[model samples]
Target: MKNINNIFLYSALFLSFSVFAQQGKQKKADTLFNKFSFVKASKVYQELIQNNYNKDYATRKIADCYALLRDPRNANRYYKSVVKQENVPVEYYYKYAQSLRGMKKYKESEIWLQRYIDSGGAPGNNDFTKNVNFISSVFGAKQQYFLDKVRFNSKFSDFGAFEHDGKVYFASSRDEGVSTKRLYGWNAQPFLDIYVAKAGTRKNVDHTAKVPGEINSIYHDGPVTITKDGKTMYFSRNNFTKGFEIKDNKGLTNMKIYRAHLVDGSWTNIEDLPINGDDFSTQHAALNSDDSKLYFTSDRPGTYGGSDIWVANINEDGSITDVENMGNLVNTQSAEGFPFINAEGVLFFSSDGHIGLGLMDIFATIKGDDNAIVDIINLGIPINSSTDDFAFTMNPNGVTGYFASNRRGGRGSDDIYAFHREPVLHVEGVVTNAINMTPIEHTKITLYDENDKEIAFMHTDENGYYQINIDRNKDYKIVASQNKYIEDYRKFTSKNLQTELITIPTNLLLNPVHDVAKLAELKDIYFDYDSHEIREDAAKELLKIIYLMLYDYPDMVIKIESHTDSRGSLSYNDKLSIDRANATYNYLIRGGIDPSRITAHEGFGSRQLTNGCESDTDCEEADHQLNRRTHFTVVQME
Candidate 1:
């Protein structure tokens, strides 16, 4: 009886100790997670899961950690287990959907997205649910940017490229020569620090060095913005002051934006902005064009989501006031941050909440005349991928700039990329009659490359206006043709242009082909020197006669006459002119004009010089070329 009692007591003691240890581990894991130390928290949760203690809660926590770390593959795996449980949180479905999308499993993603909606998740929160063809639309968006990874990126998460005073500033976790190499538990990388490099044009960077100032801290620092005068600076950092961290009641140190002044070329006197709070984070500071208003990302009170963009007016005395949230047009029920407003008052930010390709895609705001955000536009591919992309900044010109992304094939977990906005090359114009300046409706306008290959074609509207998009840095020829009219040709080049939208005003004027007298007054169709082959310029003129004969007057009969300059021998010139006439006749035959419509073809050679340039030396080269011409006369119209 004594041995039995002893055995029972020992077993009871051991069971109590095991339960106590498990409870302690759970408390520690919860604390780490609440503090945003996801990496450390995830390990603790996994240990609990392996021991079969609080398996459900640990599993869900691990999934959340992976999601925050942007490890979508691992997140998807863990979330699979989480969603199979009974009475799962509605957010789990949304998160699972996002993880699936990050893996490009779009179909499965859509199913979970629907589940989220069915489980009382707000449809407005999921942009994918609003548009039925959202995926296809995002993939089919035109690529308007060219991206290249910056050369100065380190192997340890470098991002947030900003420009100030001829230097490029960015945040990095590189700890090659730093004194304190403390790593963040969230990523296992060293805390971010601000670094500067000499800026070069279009994605070039020189030697990089740490900013020689007291701005960087032992905790997270950097991703900064400066005023245009280079005096005032705002940067994100941990809520630490005087070598000690300040924490909220939950013992979490939130991010805060600090302001510093440039005195004698070194930043000093750093102070936290008034809008910072002890509980929620307020970081990623940006300024409007004139520095009159400061914009930043925050999760403070009145936020509609995990984070939202907020603005505050910068008073004349350097005090910030009138804090306002940037409404639903710019915010959603997901993380949104890294706001950058260009000189043109255009807002560019990053969000996973908006309809996008996948995980945090860059977005731009479309504002009304009153400067209110009316719509949000996703800046599709190259600027955004299936992973996190944010921290977009543009130069004053707005054509070339830099942004950060964590997509595959980067030097770091998150790398900064330089991008150049491809110019929207287009030519728009009105087609009008040369004689009366009247709009010529139904004229077919065609665009050809330098090689005379037809690339695009359109017809003039009722108002005689036409527009055609063309490739950049190439020569293009545009032809406007209509029945009963002479074709008008215009040639232009889009080389050495840097504007985002290059609109070339190309007004075409066509002459009416009323009668033989009107046709005779048309510009001479000149041929190349010493060649009887039809030149491109001559072919354009020949097309007009073809159109008139084939479409305008099907029963019209025309006579062709060719002439040559005086440089060639009379017999050779006569033979060359006859060959030119034959070439014109063949061209018309191929253009769908009936062969019976031709009345006669002849060669006048040098005998029909339109100018006094009987010899090459008598006039300029242009005048001599005028004699080498072809003329079409309407013999009969029915």
Candidate 2:
């Protein structure tokens, strides 16, 4: 009796163990399929189907895997099968919706998108936002202006978009990106890819996903963008490729950027991006809003971390210039990449090093007047998250932008999404002369992008003030030049400085060399405020005059005069102006102008207005400004 009882117990234990083993194998198969390792995972799922086990999870995962592997036909087929099974979770609906979109079944895809949203699935991750706007953009060349809101949102993550002719053309890998296959693993799903959609409008959910095919290849493929002329396509790809794959000394794979020129209306030949074959990885390319410059990301040497964004010029020959490090201010110790240059010179990039809500977040930086690159500002919370978020592409129009994020949930490893918003650029400043407090009249200023190409030129009015109208997504070099002065310069890096940023001071203190030489015209001697003091400005002018005297004649001497406008009494004005002239004499003495050979002090109160110019009573302020002036002839130079 004891032996028979033991046998019955053993039989029961064996049955339980068998069931558990079958479930483990089934779960493992589901995981493999979700990881984008479809080739092997498919075999497991097929076994489950043959063995007649619970195939719902396995079925859904297989469909998602096919989509990630860029095999739309199979993915679409399986996704349909999951829906037919009925009572599918909202996530399953989302995957099926994407699968249909991949097949260009816009109507069906949009229906599923609606269903998913209606089923308590929120927006903000990969498929986080509405799809109406993206759908409309797919049929045209312009879309970026509509996607800015999604890109600029403080908490949303977006990327993988394309832009053209003032339009945004890109994608976002956000919401629901944390699938079982990507996070915390060795064999993670390399699931980013190329997708095209319109910006700003109510994007159709059916417009959200596509077949990918040659466009999305393996791993990741976009924020796909074309030059304004629409002659070339620029985009980013991840750790692996379809054909060319190389290993470094460390045995690690790096991302590479590629470009294809639109020849006769079709992208004819694709080539690797120049400067992208460095030891590190590189991706994402954005041309300046004006089409004069190009920006991108790379983990090349000199970067702050995993991948700091770098920029280079798109030369007239269509080649890139040597890469310039954006520096500590814009890049942090973590990964910082994906830079977008707006027309107004404010640059946007992604970084994980600086303070941010995620592993990587977007940042902005402003350029200075000296043509120097400044640090980047980590775009805070609204657009960031505790997850990995990056890849931003922008256009000046109020339409679109591309960004990426890995948030709560999504179909594949990371699916690309789309959207739109307004564009922005900022610039402001003040202008003054180099030697004196006096305002410079009609100071001409020219603005150039980082590539040294001219963007704007203006003249300072009587107030000696000028301001630049900055277009977002542009870089500029403000070159201030006048007929008698050396060039004064200001640099707007386009990353940090924006609207109402500190008023850029237009103080033109160009070297006095040009105006002080023998052949050079001596504009005038200048003095400090109210005190008639021979200030540093005065000294700078005197040095120039002294040098001219020495060069023209080894020994020369002269007198200096101080004049005042008709604002004071005769005795007081006369004595005051004399002392002012004497101050000039003392300044020259200290400036190596031999005192023995020079004499100073003499004031003609309100007496000197140039001939032919109107009198102070009837003339423009020019006459009075000239009246209250300082003058000095060639003093002794021994």
Candidate 3:
């Protein structure tokens, strides 16, 4: 009887072991699913579903895997089982909607999207309304951009297109003859590396060559941004630097931004950026045309969501400081990345948080005068789709640009697409001295768009010539400044009048600083309530005076008469006015004007009032503002 009982126990134990072995296989599937290796993960998930092991989870994952793999037919088949399943997450509804859309089932997609909103998904967030509007916008609006896939796409993921020095640079996972190429388990693709090729038009492209060892690494290395001069390069890479590695939570190495100098036709002097931290990731480095500010994506602390776009001020010494978040207007409770600022200050980035067609969509926003995000709107269809679309960039001409999209009908996982817009506007002109009418070489010319936002700035070539791209149906302000001359300002608009490119040529004739008081009336220099610091606009005006003393009229001498409104005691006003005058004097010296050029900075203490805003009487703020003025007079010019 004891032997028979033992035999029964052994049989039960064997059955339990068999069940545990099957569960292990399911766990492995979950691992793969988490890593987004859907191609491999779906096999195990489907097997588990067939065997009725965790059938609900397995079914949902199988559907999701197919959706991510862009196999909408299979995704639709599998999703049908869980789209209406009980207690599923709201994201399932969104995913189901996208899969339906990809399968060309618009009605079904809208139904799922409505269900998702009704289930309290992304409520109170413009998300629901944006998605619904996107449907109508896609069909109602005319497509403004035509996209064509480039010729260099391999059968693997390729993206992050940028153009520099007449060469096309991008990131790719193609086998680039690197023996050390290792597969990233996350997607089972080779690690990304930077590649360069000859510049090509939309129709033709040359084969690519891998960057040198100085830039490429054993790990991911690319998606680089080069300065307008192509001398400095900023790129993204893992934290493996100088034999050290930085890792974040879960022991995963995070990405960091690095800078390289173009030394003797090769990239050298690689250094990790100061904004990078080991605890998070920083990638996608982009620069404004001037290279004074670097914009990038990071998952660092203080981010609004999984990631946010941030900018760092690049100092004259080549060090970066003052990292700033792009703020709530641009970032949201989801990820935002791949920021590209065109020659115009308009910012273009990809975000999953904002209302969009699908998983991720491209959006554009203009920076406020304070350098903060002011407005944001989706780029709409063709430029955006029901899948990931990012890495947007434009040529200096603005009309021609490239972006990466993983939407259906792509040649690879992610392919670079060239886009062209019609009715392009171009601005070309020259800068010259107003007195002599001679070309002013190296003069700085700045262009501002309708919103009074800077689009771009450039130093005039040898002939004081410059050309830039501008958008039609918008107002623009062009300012020209050169050493030894007063800045020139002009305002104009492009009405999209012609089919071909329209060139608006306006030559700038800058005046000498000593002649600013004669040529253009100097405006009142305003300060914060009680602070003596000069305002930004005021500083720009003051630079005109500095230019005269320092460059144009090196022997010029000037006297400053600072005045204040009669709001305080006479003694207090006198001291305050003196402080203001000293502040302006310091500004000129700091701006490189010789101290000896200034004869005197007298504080009038409200004695010289432009209007009657006396301390003893009630007056409007505007009246007081007029009284607070700094008058400049040329004492001598040689």
Backbone clashes for every candidate come to 0, 105, 1
Candidate 1 wrongly placed segments (more than 4 Å): 1-130, 133-141, 164-166, 198-208, 368-370, 427-446, 456-468, 477-496, 499-501, 504-638
lDDT of 2 by residue, 450-478 (tens): 88887777776544545554655555678
| TM per prediction | 0.52, 0.38, 0.46
The better candidate by lDDT, 2 or 3, is: 3
Stretch of 10 with least lDDT, candidate 3: 133-142
Better structure of 1 and 3 per TM-score: 1
Summarize candidate 3's per-residue lDDT along 1-638 as a digit string, tens digits.
Answer: 11432453455455445444555676677555433245567889888777665566678878866655546788778778886766665767766776677777888888987887898766333243343432222222234566755788877888899988788889988864655668978898888888887667443322237775478776888799999888888999998888776677789999999998888888888998789888899999999879899999998889999999999899999999999998998899899999998765667899999888799998876343354544565667678898999999877765667899988888879898887655324576777666544467799989998788898887776556665667777889999987567789888878755423446767788877665445343345776555577889788888766544444566777788888888887898888889889988888777766678788987888788887678788998888877776788877777
**Clash pairs detected, candidate 3:** 484-552
Go through the candidates in order and give each one's C-alpha lDDT.
0.78, 0.56, 0.74
**Top candidate when judged by TM-score against the true structure:** 1
Model 3: per-residue Cα lDDT at residue 171: 90
